[model samples]
Target: MFYGVSALGRKWSNRSPEEHVRRWGRIAYGVSILGFASHVTFFITRWIGGGHIPTSNMYEFMTFLAMAIMFAFIVVNAIYRKPLLGLFTLPLTVIIVAYAAVFPQEVQPLIPALQSIWLKVHVTTAATGEAFFAVGFAAGLMYLLRTVDFKKTSPQARREQRWVEFTLFVIVVIIAFIGSVFSFRGAGYEATFKQENVVIDDKGIESTTTETVEYSLPPIFKPFNSQDVLVEPFLGVKKPLMETPSWMKGVNAARKLNTITWSIINGAILYGLLRLVLRKRIGAAIHPLMDGIDEDDIDEISYRAIAIGYPIFMLGALIFAMIWAYIAWSRFWGWDPKEVWALITWLYYTAYLHLRLSRGWHGSKSAWLAVIGFVVVMFTLIGVNLVLVGLHSYAGV
Candidate 1:
């Protein structure tokens, strides 16, 4: 399908600007949708099959991050009809999903620490806000690309510059997403290893496929049939697999509740997607597509997304974090490196909004601020998770 689209784009490139844009739109939309669908299936299956919330590890976190950003773009494009933006947004999604591909695909049980209902509300809302930032960042790039002038330069030169900018944007997006995912999911999963050796018993050398060697098996059995430590002669069978920890039971219950909440949220997303695609109001739809985007509207959308997202991020990073810390570690707002980065992230966005509104910034300047704000948001969201060490350092990226 991409081949056919690429062929069509080549055929149309020399035709006219309108045809060129139409061709790009079709191809970008196709690729972005394919990425979106793959993300949905992978994460949803992980959620259901694992009987856990979807943000448990790097693989799952990346999957969710990609989906959230794609969802935001889909929403924006459906309403704005700014398909050129997909040239920015869709490629970004592709990159994140590509990164996720490097991680293992098997489902793993959620650890006790991550097993909280607050995780679903806290993580999803935080991620959803980041998704909006993804769209805002794309819009900011579009504003920049369109506003930049290189009339004296050759068309090839201008095209190359645009490509470079787009590539940089993708790299930044990847850094931001991974960092944010890390902050929540932490540095990675705690790994426990196991070994096996055959032993003669009443059941005679019990053999099993590697597939049946469950990680969830008892810790004692994890070592396997060893002669080093002699067992009591009266022992008939190996110790039974340990029951799920009492602390984990609540987490499991929270997961069940989270699944229901996710269902409702997904339904809302589907409805928003429908309205965004079909609605064609003048300022909201036609203008952005026709190169008629009102600076006010662009400003408004960026403002709304950042305004809503930044605070939510702060809450996730700071407030809920404080509670989780106090519960687990008897500290609430430790000046951990991750916490410090979160504060830096918040300060960064706050400065952005300040420069935009109080300072009366607009156009390219405001767009640049929006771009920078999201960069901070992304870093806070994914970068800190991957690069910096901190209390909330679970990103496993």
Candidate 2:
């Protein structure tokens, strides 16, 4: 692996440094394709062995995340011919895939909530969109690095010689923040409830007959309080909460939901740990890295990523989400926390697009907006899944 990376680096270094970057970009594209194949193999194995969707839980979800990001990277590199960008993106892909190393192999039966065909479409589409955003992030980082003046030997330059390095460091910090929050959230990040129909002994089935609170209780801390646990009156309950059907008495509906929640929480924790340990923020940690880049390249790269990723994000987060919600929950849009956060992410990126195209908005301000837009995307994709609670809060944990 190191040999391939080194060869690509060498190949990329032979050109006007800029042209060399494209050669390395081609190499990155090849490597990511191989990695993506391997990732697919892992998912396929899990699906065959587990006999269910690849994203039924957190481990699978992450497996999908890595695959999606790599897919996006491959597509973008093939079209843009920007290999230097791969230096950032490939490391991230590696870190994401590494999470699978610690992933739990245990597979269980899917709950009713996850039994729809929408499960496959909804989660994978979201992952694919996020993958584009990942590449966009790399583009934005390069944009920032490309803007700094490294040629000057003045006092200010001397004092902040490695400003690009520092900027890279900040980006890593931001990614780390994203990964950590997701991990915590997947660990049963929020409180939720599940309602199920139960059949009575007297030959009648009571719909939404019972309500149970779901939790992502850590395995070591399982079996929590029951008596003092607050129970909200079920607004959608179809039967009386007090006189639940006899079949309802035998089922622990909360546990069913929590099982999925546990997977999501564990997945989030794994993602955070991987990001922290991979030393992924390497380029940003020192001087000399990206010292050969130009300002135009940075601006161009940022524009390309936003143009590509923003629309894809909209298709997945807004368009597809609305379609899926209508099919699954009978509503096109809900004021649920997850829905609200998605809209927030959309607005942030929309503003970014506007700012970039606006006559007075270019250069550093554009770079800043790209950065902010990515931050919003990260929160919407990982933060809301892990930190906030709501109706569409389906991070499995």
Candidate 3:
């Protein structure tokens, strides 16, 4: 809360006298350091108490990611002294910490496969690298808001404008997902479904198994092949409105689909409310705050951040990951969904760097690439883990 308040205070302080802005900046920085110190302390104590590194589970890993992001922010802020950066990164960190709450928080022991020291090195370094990429995303977004010509009616400009709006929409949807999860969770809302799937072997022998799906949020879409075991009514709605398609494959596929449906419905409503309140597109509403910011500097900050992160990401997500993979499964690469997505993320940033340095992809083009790169990173982290069953599936839980 203090971090968020300090960020907003910095925005307002920008219009004040130089002395006042400087004073407020100092206060904001101090609060940021204090918050980061507390975060690190929690991390250390959890490591000691849990008898292992805290990045073994979803909640622990996400909190670690938030800590890494804050650490990255402090470093970048120290170098550039950009108070405005806090306005975006701090809120994102808060949102992540909240999103982390959606998962079960109880500590679970590391499995034999994940018991190696390589797992710890792989997870921590990957998170730290992704933290820098997150900073790049924030800076890239700032560059876009700082430079996009919102008033231009030209086809190209309109395209850029719409993409920016969609970016804001994505952010709003994530926030909505987090908000709705907590709201329903607090209300103790739940629905359970039982799914039966029959498998036929190569010899034509068939077997049936019953699986269950539990939802903390109201089920908007039930499992593909399932019947309701229990559904507590919400606002007189007793049944799910739809069913997940067979194409959506996973043990948790139905629950994931239902959560997505709810998030979209709530996200659209929340985003519409924001539009009505601001009387403009959220991007246009925020564009004014980019005034007086140097676009080149913002672009440079984005590029430099990604540049530093790319190699670290290479070492951790790929190198360390491959080492652990070999240790755990006797293979370096098996084209698992997670591994494939990690490679895709690496190549995407590799392309970004190639275009950036050689093709002179400087300003908005580079910013857009940086922004899109993080989306790939997130899908690799959250989407693949939750939606796909692989060797790394346990991480999703």
Candidate 4:
């Protein structure tokens, strides 16, 4: 709604309508504030219900990310008074919130590894830092769209530009796919599978037992020992086209693969629809909206956001995370996928800072770095947890 109102406000501004644009803009801002407040209330409520801070799982972390994005946006807008910032930032927040909503929302008890007090401190601070990074992503994207000279680009450059825009469109489609899956869950979609496990006893006697497991989403691939007997009749395909390898350790590995497959399929469909409607790349479609905004201001906001976010991210994601790991696992670094990715994120941003400050990389170069930095952040936060199996896999819940 905030995004729609902002767009409406922009459209009305062209006709010099009677205060409607400004009124809608203020209302949109108010809605975002309300969203922040609602997130706060939800966090407190979950904290009270679960008897811990609400950053222990994907649902909680994503909600925190949404809150942090709004908080950062409100602060940035207050300083810059750039209503366009809201237009870019809020959509990203909505995507985060929507993706978060796809996860199970039921609050569960924290696992043993997550019971430490540092869980709250470490995770919340990291999320706050990444939230600011998200702001940088929005600003950097706006800067690129505003300043890039697409019309004068070479043929090869235009092809590369289309690919970049398609990638962004794919990201949006992935979010929408998650949202659609969540909706399907609400509509009683489920897939059930039967598996037979062969067990060897101490006496060398072998026994086989069969068990049935149900999944919220269709499994695109069945486990080696399992057969999907029933699947919700949706998406025109009932059974997975492939079998999950036995080497995949997780019980839900097949389901995860299925979800990824479906997301790609759905995303492709949405991308086609977007292309058909716009008759141009998504980035090109959005370029006109940045007409009046100053590229330098956008560039500086991106840089300043990174400047502010880097230290916080380092302190929380790296320092605090390492300390917590030591206390919990009695090790400084265990090469857990999450920990390694966190380190990679830190190093990436560190490199971004060095390039900007020392090499005088500014404008498009800096902005592109900021944009890529957020991609790393997202992978560390979402991709690592979802796609990779490691000590932090519990957080995917």
Best to worst by TM-score, what's the order?
3, 4, 2, 1
Q: Flag the better candidate by TM-score, 1 or 4.
A: 4
Error of 4 at 156 (Å): 4.9
Window of ten residues with lowest summed lDDT in model 2:
219-228
lDDT by residue for model 3 over 196-296, one digit each (tens)? 88889999999998998889998888988899999999889999988889887765888877888889999999999999999988989888767767899
Tell me model 2's lDDT, rounded to 2 decimals.
Answer: 0.61
Q: What is the lDDT of candidate 1?
A: 0.59
lDDT of each: 0.59, 0.61, 0.88, 0.82
Q: lDDT (0-100) at residue 128 of candidate 2?
A: 81
Looking at model 4, the pairs that clash are none
lDDT (C-alpha) at residue 277 in model 1: 79
Question: Compared with the true structure, what per-residue lDDT tens digits does model 2 show for residues 130-245?
Answer: 77777777776666655555556788654443554554544445444445445554653433444454446666855445455443332221122232243323234322222223
Candidate 4 lDDT (Cα, 0 to 1): 0.82
State the lDDT of candidate 1 residue by residue for 1-397, as single tens digits.
Answer: 3423432354446766556656666767767777688878877777888898778677777778789888887777666655556656666676677667555667877667777777776677667767777777766766654555434277865664554355453454445434433432353422133223333668676763221222211122222321212222112434422223333222122222332333344444544554477562112331233253345565566666666677777777667767776776778777887678767877877787788779987776777777777667766755666555665566553
Error of 3 at 312 (Å): 1.0
Ranking by lDDT: 3, 4, 2, 1
Error of 3 at 242 (Å): 2.3
